[model samples]
Target: MSYPTISFSGGSIDRADYIRTDPAKLEELKDWRARLVKLDGLDPVLTPQNELEWGSLADCPPGADLVFLGLRDGRACFAAVPEAGDAGALQMGSRARAAMGILGHDDLGIYGMARSLVDWHARHRFCAQCGAPTQLAKGGWQRDCGACKAQHFPRVDPVTIMLVEHGGNLLLGRQPRFPAGFYSALAGFVEPGETIEGAVAREVLEEAGVTVRDVSYVASQPWPFPSQLMVGCHAFANETELTVDRTELEDARWFSRAEVVDALTGAQGAAFTPPPPQAIAHQLLKWWLQR
Candidate 1:
């Protein structure tokens, strides 16, 4: 079966380590044809025209916390933190939301990497081992504590988002925060010591009170809204009746194949809608539709 190209999933960049331990390698940064990705807090700095806003290392303002992301087509790629107050022609907003609209597929992939790394750098400024301030190391892929000599790396939280099916219907649910009339595949963070299949089954039972079996992996996407690896799956529901936990979901229901097709295509007269194409849930639903 053919799969749609997921956003933020393709790039041919190589994360070179020549600059990782060698501070000297950073000096040649200005000599390369590099792409710059700037972040302010959790958002990326965008041009007035709404592009990713790339510039030279020399153009970065003073006090920009910079990290070499790697090589794109043999050219250096870097991410920098433009001093908050000096963001002259750039503006900041939700990276997750902005990425989908402003970036191309490959650029979106690079943005995801940058977003996750910068978030780690910002959040881990202080070391947990000895309570000392940590400094960037290994070309921004790691942090080193000066006090106790501990190192920290960026973390990717694993989340299970599964489409549960039984008979000729698929299961979907809605949370209060979701837009009106929209429903999505059930999802939750994978807990410690749990397998992906185990997590999928557990989450399905917990949220909708539907026991699931034959869990199968479908695909994964690097969701960089503060760093999550969404592990998409397809599962078979053992029963159809739902006992939705109100605290977890507002509603959970099974939709037949025809109903799902209408929702996926945004057909008029549809009672509910699936998530957008940018989300993994929408991909899962699309996969189901093709089947």
Candidate 2:
């Protein structure tokens, strides 16, 4: 069976670091050949063909900071980040969430990166250490603080999302925010200094009361909701018993392999709805079923 593309991960863009660092090269690329990704604030404006709508640099508003997204099709690409006073331009992610249902793979990846970087710039306008305003540098790749001489780069948080199995059954959970009957893999952010395996085991045990072992890596996705790296993993638990943490999960239970197959295949009578195809959790379920 063919698998769906993982959203917002596999981008085919060459981020020309050399161009970003060199003043002359970066300046030269800002000509008519350069493409600008149109954005309504931080949200994407998609073409009717479900692709990213490209515009010329002339289209960008004067005084807008242009971030170098990289080279696409051998042409320099960019996204315009508005000045800080234009708070009305920032959508605060509602539009980007809506764009998810419409974006194709490449556009999804590009927009994901654009939205995250733009959002970061909006939020991190000041130096964390010195509480001083920062300036954009290196084509929006870095923010520099003159007061403390500090440099800040974009951050991507690591989260471990895992499928825990015992006796041919897979464990799934639902949080309060999830729609009714929708269940997905248990996941949590990896604490600082924690290993991937440790995060997987700890999240499962804490949320579902399942002490899972035999942690193994499967795949990963760049979830750009404020920039997170989702580390997909699988682990097996010896016990089928669960101790659901009410604060962490609304519910947690094991489903048989057959039920999981029905969920992934979109057949009726699934015990719970699987995550959408673009989600890494959905891919993990498919991977587990195939294995």
Which candidate number maximizes lDDT? 2
The models' CA-based lDDT, in order, is: 0.80, 0.85
Deviation in Å, model 2, residue 28 alpha carbon: 1.2
* lDDT, model 1: 0.80
Q: Candidate 2, clashing residue pairs?
A: none
Candidate 1: worst 10 consecutive residues by lDDT?
83-92
> Candidate 2, overall lDDT?
0.85
lDDT (Cα, tens digit) per residue for candidate 1, span 1-291: 877677768666787776677777765764747767665555766777665667777766577677788887777878874333212211234454756876677777777788777766767788988889988887788899989999898888999999999998989999987888999999999999999999999999999999999999999998876678999999999999999999989999988999998988889988697887888888888888888
| Model 1 segments more than 4 A misplaced | 18-21, 30-32, 46-50, 82-98
TM-score (all chains, Cα) for each model: 0.90, 0.93
Candidate 2: tens digits of C-alpha lDDT, residues 1-291 = 554358898677898788889878888989989999998877788888877889999999897778898998899998887554224431236677778878888788888888778767877889999999998889889999999999999888899999998889999999998989999999999998899999998899899887888999888988867678889998999788889999999999989999998888889787899998878999989888878
TM-score of predicted structure 2 = 0.93
